[model samples]
Target: MTSINVKQSGDQPNSTHCRWQWRDEELVLLAEKAIWRPVSQELFVADLHLGKAEVFQACGIPLPSDDDRATLLRLETLCERWRPKRVVILGDLIHGRLGLTDRLRADLRNLHRRLHAEVMLIGGNHDRGVQLGTLPQHPACRVGGLWLSHEPEQPIDGRDGLNLCGHIHPTTTLRQGPDRLRLPCFAFDNVEQRMLMPAFGELTGGHDCRHRYRKWLVAEGTIVPWFDSAHSSRASEVGR
Candidate 1:
C-alpha cells in the first residue's frame, strides 16, 4: 500500500458525528453516505458508469473529455492507499452501449494486472458488450454475506443476508445557508439488510431521495444522517 498520509481536510466537516459500527473485522463507517468497509481493504463503491462520458459524447452531449481517465485515476489512488485484495463494484460498472472502449479496455486490463487483485463487476442495467463476460465470476466474490448482483432483491428473512447494490444513483438535497446542495448519499434499509452506494463515476447523475427513504448524506467528506419523513419539511424549513 502507498505510505502517503491519508489525512482528512480541515475544511471538511468533522466526521465524529457520523455513526459507525463494526461487522467482523471491517470498520464500517457511515461515510460518503455508504457503509465503508475499511478492512476489506476495498472501498466498495457502486454505479461507476465508466463509459458514460463516451456515450454522452457520442450522443452529442458536448461534455468535456478525460472524465474516464479522471475517474480511473481516482480509483487508482484509492487502490494504492487501501491496497485491497479486490474492488467489488456493486453494479452498473459500465454505461449504455459504449461498453469498454479500446483505451478503457486496455487501461482496465492494465489496472487489473497492476492491482494484483480481482475487480469484480456484479453486472447492472448499463453493462453491455463483452464487459459483462469479462468480469470475474462468483464463489470468490461476496458482499456482507450475500452474493452481489445488479439489482436489489428482497432477501429471505433471516436466511437472506446483506446485499450491497446500486442503480438508482441516490442523492439528497440539503440547504447550506442560501445555497442548496444535492449531495450524493447512501441509503440503508436496515429491515432489509441492504445498502445502496452512491454513484462513484463522475459522469453519473443522481436522483433526489428526499421524502422517499431514510439516508445518510455525504458532502464535503462528511456524513450526515437524515430520515425520510423530515427530508422535504426540513429542506423547505431550512431554505426559509
Candidate 2:
C-alpha cells in the first residue's frame, strides 16, 4: 500500500485539511477517488472494461495483448487489500458492443467466487446488450449517499443527498516546470452534488475536463489541486 501524506496550503486551508484516510465512513477521499461505505466494506469501481481488448481486436484495432488480464489483476489486488463484502460496478462494466466473451465472463465469475463477495453491475452506455440481469442484483444497493446508476440525474430534494457516478472519464492537465502532463482525475461537483469517478478500465479513454468543474490532478499516487496558473495555461494549450 502507498503511504499518503496530508499537506496544508495557505490558500486552501479547508480542502487541504481534509486528510485522505481509508476508514469506515460516509466519505473518504483517496488519490482523487472517493470511498464510501454504504453497505459494509462494499467497494465501488467505475468503467472496468473486461473484454475491451478483444472487442478492439474484433474491429481490427491491434491493441497491447495483456490489457484485459492486467485490469483484472489490478482489481484483484485492490479487492485483496480492501476485503470488501461486495463490489458495485458503477457503469460500463464491459467495453464495446461485442459484450462479455466466454473468457471475460469466466474471469468475472472466478473473481467473484475467489473474493467471496457479491458482484453487482449497473448498466451503462456500453452495457446496453449485456445481460447484467443474469448476474446477481441487490435490493437497497448504494454507494456513498446516492443510489448507483449509469446516468447522472439532478438530486431529488432530501433524498439520498448525492449521486456517485462515472460516465465521463474525467482527466485534468497539470504543468510541472516547462512540461505539461494530462492525467486521469476524479471531479466533484459541490453545487450539483455529484461525484464523477476516473475510469478504472485499462483500455478505456478519458475526456479532458476544463471549464466543467473544479479539478483535482491525480499524480504521484496523491490527489492535488490543479489550480496553479501554469496548469491552467497547460490545459488551455492542450484544449487548443
Top-lDDT structure, candidate number: 2
Instruction: Residues 43-133, candidate 2: write the lDDT tens digits.
Output: 7788887688777778899876578787777777777766778877887878865747777777766778765677788778777766643
Mind giving the per-residue lDDT tens digits that candidate 1 earns over 1-240?
Answer: 222222232444447235444244343544433344654655566777877777878888877768888877777766676667877777666676664688777776676666566787666667634444356433213555554555777544444566667787888776545555677877766766666678888887887765546666676666665643654567656655
If candidate 1 were superposed on the true structure by all CA atoms, what would the RMSD be?
6.9
lDDT for every model? 0.63, 0.65
TM accuracy, model 2: 0.77
Model 2 residue 219 CA deviation (Å) reads: 2.2
> Where in model 1 is the C-alpha error above 4 Å?
1-13, 16-19, 22-27, 30-40, 132-147, 156-158, 176-178, 227-240
Candidate 1 residue-wise lDDT at 198: 81
